[model samples]
Each structure stands twice: as structure tokens, then as C-alpha cells.
Target: MARVTKPLSQTEIKAAKPQDKEYTLRDGDGLYLRIKKNGTKLWLFDYYRPITKKRTNMGFGAFPEVSLADARRRREEARSLLARGIDPQEHLKEQHASALAEAANTFSAVAERWMALKKTKVTADHAFDIWRSLERDVLPLIGALPITAVKAQTVIAALQPVQSRGNLETLKRLIQRINEIMTYAVNSGLIDANPIAGVRQVFQQPKKKHMPSISPEQLPELMSVLTTASINLQTRRLIEWSLHTMARPGEAASARWAEIDYDAKLWRIPGDRMKAGREHIVPLTPQSLAILEFMQPISGHREFIFPGVKDPKVPMNSQTANMALKRMGFGGTLVAHGLRSLASTTLNEEGFDPDLIEAALAHIDKNEVRRAYNRATYLDRRRKMMEWWSEKITISS
Candidate 1:
């Protein structure tokens, strides 16, 4: 007959002290309090591997923090696993890995990874808009779901509200963005395939009306009206700047002083702000520079050349110019973006090199080599074209 081991008491455990070498006191079962030479107390459980029968030691935690009762409770859990022919250490590892996989495979987690890759290719403002769209439209719906578990029907349900609201453009973009993210998941090994490949097909397509613009002949009258328009000076100037630069409403509104090459008379709009997703250099004409000079006292210290009246920290709203045009009795007749069409028409009619005009407008050509040539070779001709275009739209003219 063998003698049974006695259980340790709390009083005895507290009195135990460190010595020359590390030592352990048996508490009961496989639980032990390991006292190191430096007086660090650790809780450990000694056990045999279920399959190999090799003895192993598993750590619970360090002493006083873990206490004797906690160690005993942990030892019981390990023994319970061992009794079921499972190794406690292996089970712990499996739990840890499952937790990691769960965290890594969520829609939001993988989407964040995808966005990190996008930041290198897009501008900070564009990146912020992309994430905000997801937050408002995508994340709250399915962000916590595992990537693989996200099916087309699930995504359609999330987007159905956007379609119902008649924001077809926004709905369309949201689908495209989600598709890109799912593709990113596929490339990142989070999912085998993009489930939202045909998601855009579920929504009605937005009508493709050309941006509303007046004919070339109407520009002189528009300029005449602009000279004495009731709108504020900043909005009028921004409209003029957009026309002279042939910048999209969004691009002109967010123009930064840092992007202006005053010496070269060029405004280098970075790729992220541009719809074409490339850096576009607009040839700044005398009229454009004059507008900039007039704006100096109002916004020279701010980041934006056209800062918002209410919030100097933010660039002017992209719609500011359109609203100002409406105030000038051009509502629905022309939009801020339509200024590009007006410029294109006048320049093309005047027999400027079409390719140079295209370059000035930052139009991305289908042929990659030719596109590169257009970007590289057209600055001088484009500058001259912009000068003529500027004089054509001159308020003084």
C-alpha cells in the first residue's frame, strides 16, 4: 500500500522562502509552487502526455497574483482534459490559434489590410472617403462576419437600403469598393474567391448623363454674369479658377497652396485627388494666378487655396461652385464639372492639338505608351492653349 500525499496549507505556503537553488513544494495532485533562488514564485502543473506518456510541466501563472486556489483550479482543468485523452498544452495551443484565426479573418480586419495596400496608391483624402463609405455603408452590416461566410445574398441585403434611397451612384460605388475588398481577401488568402463579383449587377445602374455644360458660345455670357453675381467673392473666384484650370469641381475645391508651382506656373494635383488616379499638372494662366493673389489675404495661411468660409481648416465643398453658378441663373444649365467640357469645346474648335488638349485635361489614354508621351511632351503646348483659353474666359475681355 502507498502513502497518500498531504495537501499544502496556505500558512505553510506563505512562510516558504527562497534558497540557493530553485525548489518546488507539492500542493496536491500535480499542482506545485516553484520558488526560484531569486524569490520568484511560479505556479506549475506536472503531467504526462496522453499519447506519448512523457511527463510535461505546464505553467499556470506566477504566485501571489495566481494564489494557491487559482493554481488548484487550473490543475483540475488540466486533469479533466488529460482524463479525456487530450493533452492540455495542445488544447491550449489550439484555442490560441482559433482565436487568432477568428480575429484575422473578419471582414473588417481583412478590409483594413486591403485599405493599407490602397493608401500607397491613393491620396489621404481619398483614403479617408473610402473608409468612411465603408463605415457608413458596409461595416455596420457585415464587418464582424468571417470573410468566407459572406455570400452575395448577404451583401445584397446590406446594399438594398442604399438602392432604395435612389442614390444609384453611391450604391454603385459601394458595390465596386466591396468587390475590391473581397478580391483583396482572395489575394491575401483570407478567402478562396470573391463572393461579390457580380454584386454590381444586383443594383440598377446610374444614368450616364454627361456633366451638364453650356456650349462654347454661352461661356462669354456666363462670365459676364459671374462678374456681378450675387454670390460671395471666394465662390466666384473658385468658379473662375475651375474654368481656367479645367479642373474637376472636386479637384479645384481641394486645391492646396503647396501644390502650386508658382515659378513654373503649374499646379501639380496629386493622383489621389484626381479622378484619373494620376498626378495632373495644370498650366496656370495669368487669370488663374490673379485669382490666387486675390485669395492671399483670405486664405494664404491655410492649407487650401479655397478654404471654406465657415471652417478654414477644410477645403471648400466641391458643390460650392455649382451652387454659385445656380445663384447666377445657370441652375441645371451648367455644373462646376461642366467647365471642362466648355474648355474642351472652345479649344478643339480653335484648332489646338487635340492630344495636347487631352493632356491638359488629364484624360488617361487607352494606349499606355502614347499616354506617357502625352503627359511628357504636351506641357509647353498645353500652357499656350491654357493661356488662350484663359484670355477667352477673361472677365475683362
Candidate 2:
């Protein structure tokens, strides 16, 4: 055993240096120093295992941040843990786990973390847009509340504004998103049950069916009016494109050049972005092809076929197309989406097979027999049907 000196005094401890090049003192009993290769000093602590007689090293922080008194107190606490057969490192791990769960307890905090995880799986733009919408609409009402405290009523309140506007689809989507977030919280051990689960009881409004299409007798006049409608060239292209393809506004809005195969006369939408999460191959008619050619000059160099006016990064806004339709005196008469109804109704009247019509619309069939047999094999027939619809509705520049 080495000759031991008395415990370090406060005055001496404050002035001590690790590299005087004259004295040697091993760090033990909470006294420590780090002698750098350049002779700079950093304080640390050292101890011996009580049972194994093996020495253990402990960091006591840098010199200025950690004073001698603070270091001694921390060392004493650590020694007490060793005496209780508990490693301070193991205790710290448990503390970290508990702190993480506590931090994730609130809706806002958990949502932020959930968005972070979602960023890895989705585009950054999509993640930011979705989280920001939740922050403004959903989070303001129940964000700071504990995930466990989020009741069905809270979710219903968040969706009331959208629901009141007859946006039941959007309401359903927002509610589903909240439920998904709550499910994630449960998975992370921050909540027990998903508050949004089976939350349909909260919605008293009866679900409304899609609007009826314009009567057949009004089709010729509607087409004539649409032809002379004073809208932008891009807006005209969108209207014509929608009518020609009978596709959803979202599908046409986000259509990309790479998705279009001019040779095969097909527009292939990827499964991930498609609402049904199934790849859709739209057989293009001459009219749809003509619109694509006309728009190519503007969008050929870019990624999105129908680029937004303000930002080339995104597709054209769905609102722009709807507003253009409304401006043509078609509000509540012929929506941008009403084209699907027009086509489906007209084709069914024309004696086309129901399976073929459903396949053209990419609407999932409910009947197992129809779904099992529907393979979209009538591309040529669809191409002809779309051409006839386009000829019926003419949009002048």
C-alpha cells in the first residue's frame, strides 16, 4: 500500500494541475485528472471493485464545469450504488428508458416523434405537409394532452369543421390518421387503447353519396358551354384530360412524364401513390394523347406532367381544376370528378359489361366473382370508349 495523504482541501483542489512534472498522484476516491499529450488537464474519478479488487474508471466531467465538491458528491453517490450491487451504468439505462416513455406521453411530442419515424418511410415534403396539417388542425385541440386522455370526442371535435362542410371523406381520412397515430402511441407504450378506435359513434351525420351526374339531355349544352369557358390553357388541358381519361383529380394532378408511355398509349400510376394502393395502367385514347402532346411543351422538361402554377415542384392543385369547373356555371352541376359518373353512366347505358366499366374506373369490385374475373383485358375497348366520351365533350382553347 502507498503512503496516503489527507483528503484534498477546497483551496488546494481548486488550484491543482495534473502535469506539474514534479509530483505524482494517482486518481482514487473521487480525485481525478486527465493529462493530455500536450499536458492539458481534465478531471476524472477512479475506484476499485469491492469484491474483485479491480479498479474501475469514472468520468467526473471537465475541470471548469465540475468543481471538486460536485465531483466528490457524484463519486459518493456512485460508490453507494456499487455497495448496493447496482452498477450506475445499468441504473442510467433504466432512467433513460423511463425518460423516453415520459417524453413520448403527450400527443404533440409523440406526434413529432411519429413524424420523424414517418419521414424515413415517406417523402420529406409529404411528411412535413401532413404533420403541419395535423399541427394546425388536430394538434391545437389535443396535442398537449396525454395520449391516453385523447377520447373519441376529442377526435370528433378535431374533424367537425371539415365534416360541417360536407367533406365527410376528408373527415374520415383525418380521423383514420388520428387513430393511426394513437395506435402508434400504444405500440410505443405511451398509451393503452386507441381513442379513435371504432369512433364512428361520434359521427351523427349520415354519409352522403357522390353527386348525381348531369342529365343526358343537358350533356350537349354542357359540352358547348365548357368549350367556350374562359380558362387558362393549363386549366383547359386539365378539364379535357379529366373528361378524356375519366381519372380521379388526384391521379391526373400528380401525373408524371415517366408514367406515360407514348408508344403503348398508357399512363401507369405507381401503387404507392394510388388511393387503392394498386398499380393502375390507363389505356390512353387519341384525345388524351392529344392533350398530353399539347402540354408536353410546358411539362416535358419537368417531372410533373401538370405542374402547379406557383411551384414547379408539385402537381397542379386540385382546387384550381374544381374552381375552373365551377366558374363555367357547373357548380353542384358538374364537378371535376363528375366526369367519372358521366362516363360510367353513359357506358353502362351503351350496354358495356359492368366488370369492364368498373375496371376502367379502377374501382375495386365488391363481388368476389366479378373481382376474380376482372383482369382489365379490354384495353382496346376502353380506349375506344374513352375516345367516344372525349368527342362528346369538346373544350375550346
Q: Highest lDDT: which candidate? A: 1
Candidate 1 regions off by >4 Å? 1-92, 395-397
Please report how far candidate 1 places residue 37 from its true position, in Å: 26
Off by over 4 Å in 2: 1-96, 109-133, 144-146, 149-170, 196-200, 366-373, 394-397
Residues 1-397 of candidate 1 have per-residue lDDT tens digits of: 9767788888878888999989998877888889999888899899999999999899999988998888898899999999999999999999999778877789898889889998888766678789999999999999999888789999999999999999998898889889998999898777788878998887899998888899988887898888878888999889989988998788899999999999998899988787767999998998999999999999999999999999989999888898888888889889998899999998999999888888888888999999887877888988888999999887434
TM-score per prediction, in order, is 0.75, 0.67
**Model 2 whole-model lDDT (C-alpha atoms):** 0.74
lDDT of 2 by residue, 346-389 (tens): 77887877767888888877776756666545677777766666
Clashing pairs in 2: 34-42
Candidate 1 lDDT (Cα, 0 to 1):
0.89
Q: In candidate 1, where is summed lDDT lowest over 10 consecutive residues?
A: 388-397
> How much lDDT does each candidate structure score?
0.89, 0.74
